[model samples]
Target: MQLLLAHVTGIQLSVRGVWELLRTHGWSCRQPARRAIERSEAAVAGWIKETWPSAKPLPRRSGPGSSSRTRPLSR
Candidate 1:
């Protein structure tokens, strides 16, 4: 509202009013993701078991110290 107030000369709009207008226009409120509705549980489970492991694979520790850049550069 602070940013919007600057653009208008005298119009007053509250956060509640803005949300009401968005709702009236068939807009969803606070939907972070829609996958829970469209995606199936079995498919998600399968991906987690198969594709997810490869997609976000655990770090290949080149024997522990090799992966740690925070250690002394010479060490």
Candidate 2:
């Protein structure tokens, strides 16, 4: 069980040990497909836009003397 978890996380594990475990359990795991990557990216982007619609237009800062001049901060 520990070896299987390690394999899924891409951490170092004894190949023989994991192979034996899989053979005993008759199971296997494969890497995610390209379609899954695209779906996940789209889902995240949608969630961000839905959650923060006002965040699209970021606030602008005033340039020096563009408005009323303010005193510079002292060290």
Candidate 3:
């Protein structure tokens, strides 16, 4: 963000200065969402169709199942 600001406006600002400027203008930072740039739709579809059914079932029947909360929720 700081580098982009500097490139576009030709004004280099420090990290603190940039945050302060944004805060004064009611701007807030948000995390950028991640995406798989090199993902292949065909490969993923093939894997899901071919490998998913063969995958072992989760949590064997003999194993301890799920646990309940120690305390109940309060209204």
Candidate 4:
């Protein structure tokens, strides 16, 4: 759950937040290092999976001077 929250939300919520949420629900906090290690491993595994050979190439941009309507917006 914490791993999902951290990955999906992209927020590095503190250990205190995790502890408080668990405590509120009458659950005990797991070791902080264990949680951190799990999260880190999950993140690395995700990255590896995402960057594997099957990954699609990013779309190429048209590059500089490719557009004709170039007047500055501020002017």
Q: Which prediction has the highest TM-score against the true structure?
A: 3
Give the TM-score ranking, best first.
Answer: 3, 1, 4, 2
lDDT of each: 0.70, 0.68, 0.84, 0.70
User: What tens-digit string does per-residue lDDT give for candidate 3 at 1-75?
Assistant: 799999999999999989998999988887657758998999999999999878957865574444667855454
Instruction: Score residue 68 of candidate 3 by CA lDDT.
Output: 60
lDDT per residue, candidate 1, 1-75, as tens digits? 534753774656677776776689988657666555676899889999989878896888564354577775454
TM-scores for the candidates = 0.34, 0.23, 0.38, 0.28
Each prediction's total of clashing residue pairs, residues at least 3 apart in sequence or on different chains, is 0, 0, 0, 0
Write the candidate numbers in order of decreasing lDDT.
Answer: 3, 1, 4, 2
Worst 10 residues of 2 by lDDT: 66-75
Model 2 lDDT per residue over 1-75, tens place: 665577788765577776776778976677645565346876788889896677678778655443435865444
What global local distance difference test value does model 2 have? 0.68
Across 41-60, the per-residue lDDT of candidate 4 in tens digits comes to 76778888887646877778
Q: Which stretches of candidate 2 lie over 4 Å from their true place?
A: 1-13, 31-45, 48-75
Worst 10 residues of 1 by lDDT: 64-73
